[model samples]
Target chain A: MRKIVQIVLAAALLVPAAAWAQQKGGVVIRSVSEVEVKQKNAEGKEEVKRVDATKTKVLPGETVIFTNYYTYSGDKPATNVVIKNPVPDHMIYLDGTAAGAGTRIEFSADKGKTFGTAGKVTVRSADGKERRAAAADYTNIRWTLEKPLNKGAKGSVTFRAKVK
Target chain B: MNTRTASIIVGLLLCLVTALAAPQGAAAATAACTGIGNTASVAYSVAGAAQTPVSSNTNTITVGNKVDVVVTTTDASPGPAVVPNQVDVLLHYTITNNGNANQRYQLSAVDLATGVTTSVFVGNQTVTDAVLVSAGTATTGDNAGAALATTATVAAGGTLNVTIKATMAAPPLTDGAYDVFALRARSLKVDGTTLEANGSSTIDSAAGTCTADVVLGDGAGTDDAVAGASPDGSHSARSAFHVVLNNLSVSKSSAPYNDPINGTTSPKAIPGATMEYTVVISNPGGSSATAVTVTDILAGTLTPVTGTPTWSSTNGGNVPCTNQAVANIASGGWACVGTGWAGSTLTATIPTLLSGETATILYQATIN
Candidate 1:
């Protein structure tokens, strides 16, 4: 009688264990880590750098110069890198040049508010007051480099513009 | 012996009942199975197709002319979806005067499928061509001659910027699907210069492509079917009308003997010497008949006629023939008829006119 009771109890436990294994069907919970957000300054400086407002402050009709340095780090070459800079108020933008690749430049008339094809920029006299606004009335300029920037190599473009 | 036998019998019966219940419980648990089976085995398929690349796209210009080319790609779907539906390729080009003399090249865009070509030169300059295509061939042309082509001096370089936008067609495609397209750019040769055979690079190819699934439900029938019962049991109606006024006379003639010449003459002359105009008004109707009013509202160089206007028999009575009190016409308000014209609405009315009437108001004015 004792042996029979032991056999019945063992069979009941086995039945539950088999049923649990079949229902679970080998599902494993994966551990996932959250991604951190990082912010950096415009000059590519990771640290907090103070920009001298006086150096960057430009007056109307005065020219301001900006130099851009681009370095690629990936294995494949970077062919087209679009660099856009908004034209601040009272200033006009100019063309830029790089050594190896030729440059194609354009400007936007709607302040740096919106950029479009050269023909799309329309300039009409605001209230017909003799001042003409046209596609030529560009506030932003863009340059496309003809040659690709190789990995680990740096390229630079220089531009000069006058304040409006 | 009696007590032991009874106990044994009860035990046997209990054992039999438990055996029957155990199998039933197992069957019930198995019947509750609701697993997803296998997701990997359920495959989602998409129709993969290859599109022909653009070849021989060209823009012609004068010696110092520029043109822009925009290349765009479209997916098979026409409606908006969660994924990107279009891509843009901008090309800024110029015709340079490299030779000893000036040359001209005709510019055109050729439909790859139909082979029908269209000229694209504006005035004496080369106009950028924007091409839209589905899964077929496309190309543009340059360098036909002094005839309707781009002309440029050898030393001058004309600048142009081209933009192309490829829009996807209707119907949503499944996610992770792609549509392929090609762009071909070639220059036409004029004079002794051979056309450049090495076409420009492919603007875009099949790279990152994605789409989303969109489901639509049946609502009211789209065609002229009634959506709901109208409150008044009347069918809604929509109509439009236009009226043109012609042969009206406006001049700076001498003032009538009874009226005083209190206003000054404008320095600017009336348009066409005689003020003859055609008035057009459109009414989109609902419950109210849209008011159509015509008023002469000119400032500075434009002055209204001193007397009332004469209307054709078809004209509505809204515009009076005599010079009434001046009223202010709100920037976008109706013509003020009676007394609101004192401040800024001189020479115009302030009341909203009703629909389907032709009212011609004649006024005279001089430039300040």
Candidate 2:
């Protein structure tokens, strides 16, 4: 029994320290939306109105604003903070809707893994001819912060897409 | 065989068998991860350290409860009424659920306003409510007045026709009197929540609850969070109805008079004899007839008489159409004879013939 105990302790010491290390710092992401509404004004002219999109139903061919919020709740600042959002199915990303201050916006034709600025990203056609990708060709959106996000600091990036 | 050679052969066979069976076990282990969840991962780096990656807890995006609808009236201008007050005018409207989810809608009729003249509905008074009926098609059905049952549900991308049978006001409304009817619709949720009208919401798959349902975006962001216990909400619109009438028709006849050979009451055409012509314009509807003008064009072969034409109504009362205005119209048409007529034409302008009334014009012309 003494020999068995000695061997068990020796085996435990051989395990890597990284296996038990706790995560020190991280970020949290949340998403929300806004929708456009049209109602007749007192003069009976159609006026555009904005409304909350929570639990709201959207029709086909309508526009929706999708915002992704990111907050750093870590012990240390995080660098190269990049956020990515895939365009929802049955929706087309509206051009010029991506907006985030101090962030570089890029679009992806491939699923969120690779991104480039519009007119710079090139895709090969079925006939093997290469052409600059249009904004409508984007399937994913990415935002890379210009500065490191300090702990407890938050920022949001938004874009609009139209229901197909 | 040599022992060394036989042992090597046995070892090679065993290695081949193990390689073939290993992939089957790996494939079985890989097939067990089918579940409902979303995946999100974020990566960051610390000073002097390589980037570390952390994956979010399995989150889910639920299908949002979005309610959008549109209501439209069928006709803009309905015309040519056969009779007023006796005819029940049926107006049609279609309500469509233009949202992304199924929904129930409540409908009601609001009153048409009085003398404030507008081209479309602008008032909100609930008048004598008309009978509302639901039908599969917009046409070919009649239903009595009753509140639409609460259970009537409209699916996304579906439409329903609502018919309002408005009984025309008694004592016959005056011609050109207008009334407007407005149709209103409100959407209801199964949880008894009235969804906002003509609105929509979207769920963020990365931030929404992938593990469980979590409702967010409560009016703080662009998305309006539906207040779960709020009152039912509605969208409103209006349509107008105008009073008008069908026109009256005119008929003409002739008889031979003072004939030396044939009888004076003969219906045949004759020469060297006097002929009497009668023009009758009748209004058979319950609406007033406006701009009643009768024109009689005589052939140049017939000479005009020296006397004025006599006019009468349905009650045998003679209309004093003594003076006439002879006007040139299109060819093959008739004009009423008047004092200024140098040609073979006759015309009488009688304005404002009341409903259910008839007017007649009698003139005399002789054969050349």
Candidate 3:
């Protein structure tokens, strides 16, 4: 009984240390807004560049790119990695904008109650009738990585939304 | 007739509902000062066991005010036909708020400029300024509401009806004369003090916690406004006053009734010859002419004959000329039409000779 107690206490202390390590070097997610700006390059050619949206004015009817950058710094690989984001209030998601490398994109029209790929999402309006969800009806976006993210792996998923 | 009237009323009501329900265009947007923010989350498992989900820092940016509006003249082209010297002619306009916030506008009207001329029947414009009035109803009912230089708060996606009350200024306006006006609206901030700035103005560009700024979104309207910054804070529409005048003319004809030498045979002017005269006034216009006076001065050799003056009016019809002697003028039932004779001088007056109307006066005189 004394030996079993000592083993159990050791296991309990080890679990917390692992949790602390995970907390320190686990997945890190950062959201950024991108704005397209047009300027003359060195060759005097008109070129567009993505700038941080925080430094400029964001008005209605303008498109904003919302990007989530992630990195896995844990010692072990991460599996079933999924990222979820909501279509913010007063903004509508643009179709054909949800993109990530080696990932499958899904949308939720009923606020995460159910999810499906673009054309399969369904929405029920206030009239109690169901209809195929359009890009504007999507309330949430989810991206699932197809492979495990190895330690020190970093990637970004992006979606564009326009102010209402 | 009642059923026909009811149907017309129904049609008008339907139009009113449609106008009130929907604004003209698709410039609607999120309200200004509203914060839009989002936070992302992620879920993962390490070594086949689920780890607690993690959430990112919420990224937020405030939506700025999109200051935009569209102004259009509701009055049909070459609007209401105003006769010369007519006052209080009204023209209608609408200002639709296409912005994301409510707005009050300082209103003004001026002639369309940049050398853009409007025409048909072409005549010089007399009126330059107009007193804007808030329209009380769909119809410009006597230019209702007080003369206003500004408007009440117009909510987003809403419209305000305005009317221009102007005089046919500087009368003696030639027939078909017109004065074109552009009614302009300059947006004022909701506080009623500061004028709204255009997108080109320098403003704090910081993007968090609901900092509202203005972005000009109006197109160059009929007033020839430019599409860029400063002046874009205002929009204008076109309206006009057209002159519709009565065409009136008068003429006199003289003939020999009898000559002293050759009685009733190709009579020529001779001393003591009896002469007959007729005076006619005709109006061929869409409007009526009132208080028209005709006078004839027969100096030196003419003498008036008593009880021979007679007059009649056909009022645009080819009715037989009915005559009543001067002695019966009192009973002619036309108290407004009169002819007076004082020693070879003749005068005729008509009040309210309607459209396409004619009046003729006949009298006998003698050459002394």
Return the TM-score for each candidate structure: 0.19, 0.45, 0.67
Candidate 1, residue B258: Cα displacement in angstroms equals 52
Better of 1 and 3 by DockQ: 3
Best by lDDT: 3
- Residue by residue across A12-114, what tens digits does model 3's lDDT show? 3567755422334679999998778899999999999998776666778889999999999976778889999999988999999999999999999999989
Q: Which residue runs does candidate 2 get wrong by more than 4 Å?
A: A1-85, A88-105, A110-115, A122-136, A142-164, B1-66, B77-82, B85-88, B113-130, B135-151, B166-171, B191-232, B249-368
Choose 1 or 2, whichever is better by TM-score: 2
Q: Estimate, for each residue in A1-164, the C-alpha lDDT of model 1 and write its tens digit.
A: 01111112343456664321111111111111111223486877676433322222222233444444444453334444444444433334443321124555445676556555545655546675533345336666454555554557565444444433
lDDT agreement with native, every candidate: 0.27, 0.50, 0.65
Model 1: residues with Cα > 4 Å off, grouped in runs: A1-60, A94-101, A111-121, A124-136, B1-368
Clashes of 1: 61
Q: What TM-score quantifies how close candidate 2 is to the native fold?
A: 0.45
Could you give the candidate ranking by TM-score, starting with the highest?
A: 3, 2, 1
**RMSD list, candidates in order:** 39.3, 24.4, 11.3
lDDT of 1 at A92: 46
**Could you give the candidate ranking by DockQ, starting with the highest?**
3, 2, 1
Model 3: chain B TM-score relative to the native chain B: 0.56
